[model samples]
Target: PGRGRRAGSRRVYGTLEDLLGGDIFSDFFRTFFGDFERAAGRRPGRRAEQELEVTLADAYTGAVKPYDIIGPDGRAHRVEVRIPPGVRDGDVVRVTVPGLGDLSFRAKVRPDPQFERKGDDLYVEVPVKLTTCILGGEVEVPTSTGKLILKIPPGTQNGQVFRLRGQGMPRPENPSQRGDLYARVRVVLPTRLTDRQRALFEELARLETAETYAGAR
Candidate 1:
């Protein structure tokens, strides 16, 4: 569309005109030939890929999302892309740019605040009170959809992990089957023990000591 000139400075980005050289008319012919070759089932060169960042939710369920990209003119331009379901981080997705060929987009899936993904599995840490760990109780756990109650067995140790089947991310190609979710326990210690609490713990400690002595004997 415009005349081409020698580079006065390094170009940050440009259209086919920057790469093809000469005026828009010349570049138009070059693009025409390139598209023609592509349609004929041949590639002219290596395809270029642009990085796109998408929300975790969008990547999880797949959606047509609008994103802004900086153009060669240094202005933000809005473009829409169809994100496939179960698109993991660094996965590339094809994009259709008008009059442009041999280009794609690589998706950067944002991290979820509550869940950490490994392959298809998900992991989350839940805080369990000391009393709950010792006496057994139910604690609320965070999941993709909502909260669920996780039963803690008596004598549950800190850092223990519990697995919930079919609660993790869905398979990329299959939505019916899903991975597992792991909840790691983080025991919360009691602070500023009261007189009765301290006495009870002291008695428990003595009892454990007596048991150990009897075992040794």
Candidate 2:
């Protein structure tokens, strides 16, 4: 009778071990955890944000960029990002990946040396020769598209602003519409003057004084 009792105890212990170490236990825990998460209104994954730096030209022309991000499993993933035209700085782009939560990209536009942007307008300083400022002529001006020859009016003063329509940055909302470009004139004076040039200026100064002061006191 004792031997039978010992055999029954061993059988009960073996069954308990099998129950604890089998797929049934795993399924039970998974269901419990899933139900708990649903009841708590929580998700199982995380979201990530990253920053991408782009040039002003790229923002104007649009481009395909690539990025690498770290995954939850400590692995690296390469992602290709499609950038649209007319994306301003501080714009946020969202991308979704399968099995992963939403990924956000914050855009940062780099500064350009030739132009200063304000809203949709672009400002540039174009140097004009002193002779061109005094005498009307054409000067080469740089634009987003290409170089343009701009006519300078006679006696154009330094710091004078000239507006070129439809030559500025594209509007972010509507890329087909563009803003204006303002080009400020910067007069470049002659540093070294020849003897004949100095003599001619002196003669002109004397003539100016006599012609203007002859009628005055």
Best by TM-score: 2
Superposition error at 82 for model 2 (Å):
2.5
Model 1 local distance difference test score: 0.68
Compose the digit string of candidate 2's lDDT tens values, residues 1-217. 2223122112111223343343332322332334434533444452223457777788877766665443545344556666677788888777776554455666777789998888778899999999999888989999876888899999788888999998887887888988888999999988888999989878968778555445333
- Looking at candidate 2, the ten consecutive residues that score lowest on lDDT are 5-14
The whole-model lDDT of each prediction reads 0.68, 0.68
Question: Pick by lDDT: which candidate is best?
Answer: 1
Tens-place lDDT per residue, model 1, 18-43, is 43453333322333434444533444
Task: Provide backbone clash counts, one per model.
Answer: 1, 0
In model 2, how large is the Cα lDDT of residue 211? 53
lDDT of 2 at 212: 46
